[model samples]
Target: MSDNQPSPDTILRLINGYWSTGILGAAAAHDLFTHLEAGADSAAQLARRAQISERGAQTLLDGLVSVGLIDLAGGRYRNTAAASQYLVAGRPADLSALARLKLTHMGNLTALPEVVRAGGPVTDAAVEVADNPHWGQVVPAIAAQSVPAAAVAADVLQLERAGEISILDVGGGSGIYSATWLERNPAARATQLDWEPINAIARRLLAERGLADRFTCIDGDFHTTDFGTGTYDIALYSHIAHQEGPEDNIAVFTRLKDALKPGGALLVVDYVVDDDRAGPAFPLLFASEMLLKSKQGGTWRRADYHAWLTKAGFSDVSFHAAPPATLVIAR
Candidate 1:
């Protein structure tokens, strides 16, 4: 191949991307990183601890090492710093569950070709609601992924400086936002609106964090639910917009605008593409997932958001870059 010509290496990597997913998923399932962090060093030790064949353990370890998630030092295996922090169970910011959860949906991507041709998932309902049975597991994994961005939102809104505040979390899966913000302001209380099943998960999680008293759940569909007028100091529409159509988003934004008390803020956090939609690789590619899963959803442009929020009666709108996601604030 000529130096200036395209390289097959990129295409090869893209085609074999599932190899990494399977490797990460299997390691997470076995709590391999957690074991490594707990001092299980050699493949033999891992095999004994996990009740697996030593050969299997060594193969998995080598795969993890190649993926930069495990470090192999002289006769021992250990989690890399990144893996130790984010792939070990029980860590504060652990994403091990998220890695495992991705495995459950990997097969769904195979439907993408047909889905794209049909312009959406084949079913009448979007895959989001269509997979309600897994919400109990799915929501919390997503909540873990949202931690950093949620903290940034709480800081940007200065929840710590505020007095007693009332928050409305629309589709607040796992109550992560409520927990994060309420932790910052002891006087703050939050109500999350979601399905009863998902609310149950959020309640259990918030209670486990000793936040039960300050958090509440209103189980219902956000589309038709009543968001009482001027009842909230803050309203969150995080990670939900990318799964909705423009009309639905505008309608929800309008309701959120009406739900906010005077001087209140509404925060929307999601993978947002630039106006041209040509770059910002993650958000651009995330659109494909939306196309395969939702009826009329995709990573939308910043301009689209500005227009939607403006149409929804949000007079003041601004955007903030929160790594892994973007925050659009409207008031």
Candidate 2:
């Protein structure tokens, strides 16, 4: 076989992808990262702490090291910086729950062929449901991942200098954006629009962060819920676009634009594909998840967003790279 010819390596890696998720999920389920962070340095120690066999602990530790999530030295195991920061339980930005959530949702991906044939989620309320219990577990877990993006958005918009701004956070899961903005600017207040259950979660989280006074929530679907016109200085439509069809996105965006005060900014953050739809690997693959989870949803291209924002009555639009996601700003 020539070097130019195709290789089975990529295909094999794709076929074996679940092995990585399984290993990571098992570690998370066993709280291995938490144990390691708490000084379970050896396989024997980990087994005792995590209540697994020493052999099993050793194998799992080796697998974690192979996956670059753990480090081994002098026969002692420890979490890598990334794992320590994001996977260890009780860390400020802990994503252990998100790991578990992804593993739980893996079953949805297995039915991709059926979803493709049916053109949407074949299961009852797999993802696009308003009051689905999955949102309860999902919203909080995914919030940690948005911490960096939210902070960046706050900075990019100069919320600290803007002074006395009102924000509308549409589909504001966990209220991270509101929390971030309120923390940055003492005069900033926000209202999140989401389901009642989700709003309850956001309320509790914001209160826990001592932001309840500045962060309020309204329980309603963004599809039909009225976004009061000229009410907010900034409007945020984050992450929800991927689950919506093009028409729904346009309609909601129009509402968001109308909700913003004159000269106010509308920020949309999501997994946006390049216009050619060829690369930026994650967003392209994420479209598959939308297929499994939504009726008419997929990752969209820059051109699609530009057109939608223009049609939504925004006079200007700009895209910002936030890494692992993108932000589209319109005014």
Segments of candidate 2 deviating more than 4 angstroms: 1-7
Write down the lDDT of every candidate, Cα atoms only.
Answer: 0.88, 0.89
lDDT of 1 by residue, 179-282 (tens): 88888999999999998988998999899989999998998889889999999999999988999999999999999899999999999999998898886788
RMSD per candidate (Å) reads 2.0, 2.0
Off by over 4 Å in 1: 1-6, 73-75, 124-131
Candidate 1 lDDT: 0.88
Candidate 2 lands at a TM-score of 0.93
lDDT of 2 by residue, 1-331 (tens): 8989998987987898887888898899999999998988998999999999999888888889988999889878889999988898887678888888788877667788988898877887645567688778888889998887898898789999999999999989899889888989999999999989899999998899898998889999888899998999999999988988889999988998899999999999999999988879999988988887677888999999999999999989999988779989999
**Model 1 weakest 10-residue run by lDDT:** 123-132
